[model samples]
Target: MEQPAASGPPNVAVRAAEKRGYAVSKEQPERPGRPTLDAGRSGGVTVVGDPPRRPHARQRISTTLDLIRANPTGRIALKIFIAIAGALVVTIGIALIPLPGPGWLLVIAGLGIWAVEFHWARRLLGFTRRHVHGWTQWVTRQSLPVRLVLGAVGLVFVATVVWLSLKYSLGIDVVAEVMHYLATH
Candidate 1:
């Protein structure tokens, strides 16, 4: 004689169990309706299934930090580590921002790094996301000619910034060089 399994969706059961904080058990019940050993948040209710499946990557990383924070010394160390790493990323992003080549990408990445550990950064990231999304939506909705004009304006802006940066920061006068080349030819 053998006991039959409980009848319900396994995924739902697992999710409910995990949300209420119980380790999942794959084994079939010794007796139907009998609770697992680590079954309940309190005597008021029971979670009769397994824990959540592997968490998302973000959750996994957060759990690692949670584990580290169990110790007071480890908590301090983690904060210091996050601060230094985030600052380094932001600094590099700032340095590269004037010259292009994934400069904005790096700066956003740096902001993301800081957002993980700081509330201010998290809010700022949200604001940035919203504004960028709005801009993209606005651009996509415009007429072809309007969009083309906008693109031309953007190109001109980039060219001006690049020319100025090279000339002023590196002493490389691109317009003069181009003129000299044209004259020689």
Candidate 2:
């Protein structure tokens, strides 16, 4: 019976040990109370745990606002161009909001464009965010019936505007004439 070679290369022995359910440590010393190879499980790999999550909304908003505010005296043409581009981005973003593509992100960009030109935009953005935040909290507290009624009221208001526009701008006479013709033949 020939004795097996003790070692050829370090990787060969380490791989063999790993296959047989053992870990080959790097140069670092193992921590006390930490299990080595066989005491835990068959795999040689170890998973390091996730870091703790931290809140970052304030940091992000401040950084973004600062970048926008930095160009206060930038060119008018550039500002207009940026606003148009941002509006297009926001339009596309709004369409994608219900599906994907980060609609809120485009809205922020649109606000940033307006913020570059107008104090009202800044105030409006602040008001919108505050109201939105409050409304979200309020909605969670409200009953379903209250939400449904509010939604219906909003829909009716929109429908009334549409109805009035069609009646006045497009003329009720044309509508009636079309209806009369349709009914006749």
Candidate 3:
């Protein structure tokens, strides 16, 4: 007997299974070549979804790199330009590091900018990507309290560094200014 179709949000794999006259079950083990969300879930937890289909930036970068690589005569000039641009980006990133912004990301991006033309940069970028991915996974696996405490500690460290920098550079504490304003007002 044909059972009533499962009523819920549409899923690609479930639809496909229904089309093929196969019963769809939430607890059904994933079969090869099937896009099963249940396969990705463990103990009611999902690790990651599908990756992006296409990255525009990646396409642009590859196109630019291919153009540079094809022109053997202009290779040296291109390399020089790439190096200068990457160095400038890295310098700017370093300057922004203590200013509460995407400093490290910019630095990694600069390395990526260089990676297109430099083998060493490519290796370094891959290494950084791997380590960062592992670190992210490890952090995600930590208990909430542990994660919160680590975050608090990091915040305190950055605050302390910022305070010291402001005190040394401008001879005034921002906290003191805020306090003075509060007391006078």
Candidate 4:
């Protein structure tokens, strides 16, 4: 291609950008490293994604896990320890599930712990996360009244579980007590 006299690259750049379907502008080009609207569409916008993530603590385990994995016996020991820890947390969560607390949260936490070392657990955890995220998105998309009704339904479910747990585990029937009080009043 023949160079356009000595008119410089600015005009050529604008023509090139326009040809590429960019939102070209005549504004002065910003310095390197920082793009501007004149540069193109979505220029100058620093859209950072979610921070780097891991199911486990990276800093704490990075060096230690490598060191331990290097030894044959240590690998077995590590697996054993992880299994025991994950099982303990899950057991606690199962025991607490009937009560009013973070039982499900603990269960998921235990799964995350297992996921740190187990491929099966990682896949299961991912499945659980995707479903939960979908549920959240669905709920958010609903109307206000529908969302409120869903919240009320959740409250009722929790209340029933709490009542059942108290009655069965501690021999205390809170619902019956409240009913008796209401009758006397």
**RMSD after CA superposition, every candidate:** 9.5, 16.1, 15.7, 16.3
What's the TM for model 1?
A: 0.70
- What digit string (tens of lDDT, one per residue) describes model 1 on residues 1-185? 22334432355655655565555544432544444443344443544565425445764465556545645676688878878888888888888877867788888888888887788999999999999999999999999999999999988988888999999999999999999999999
lDDT of 4: 0.71
RMSD of 4: 16.3
Model 2 per-residue lDDT tens digits across residues 1-185:
23322222245544655575544442323433333344264454433344423325654444334333434442455567767876787787776554334776778768766775667778978888898899989977899999999889977775665556667666755557778999999
Candidate 2's displacement at residue 28, Å, is 35
- Report the Cα lDDT for residue 27, model 4: 40
Q: What TM-score does model 3 achieve against the real structure?
A: 0.61
Better of 2 and 3 by lDDT: 3
- Cα lDDT computed for each candidate against the true fold: 0.72, 0.59, 0.70, 0.71
Please provide, for model 4 over 13-130, each residue's C-alpha lDDT reduced to its tens digit, 9 standing for 90 to 100: 5465557555433443233333223324243444224442332355336545644554567678988898899989989998888787989999999998898779999999999999
The residue pairs in collision within model 4 are none
Candidate No. with top lDDT = 1
TM-scores of the models, in the order given: 0.70, 0.38, 0.61, 0.66
Cα error, residue 79 of model 1, in Å, equals 1.5
Give, for candidate 4, the lowest lDDT window spanning 10 residues.
1-10
Ordered from best to worst lDDT, the candidate numbers read: 1, 4, 3, 2
The candidate 2 region of ten consecutive residues with least summed lDDT is: 1-10
Q: Over the full model, what C-alpha lDDT does candidate 1 score relative to the true structure?
A: 0.72
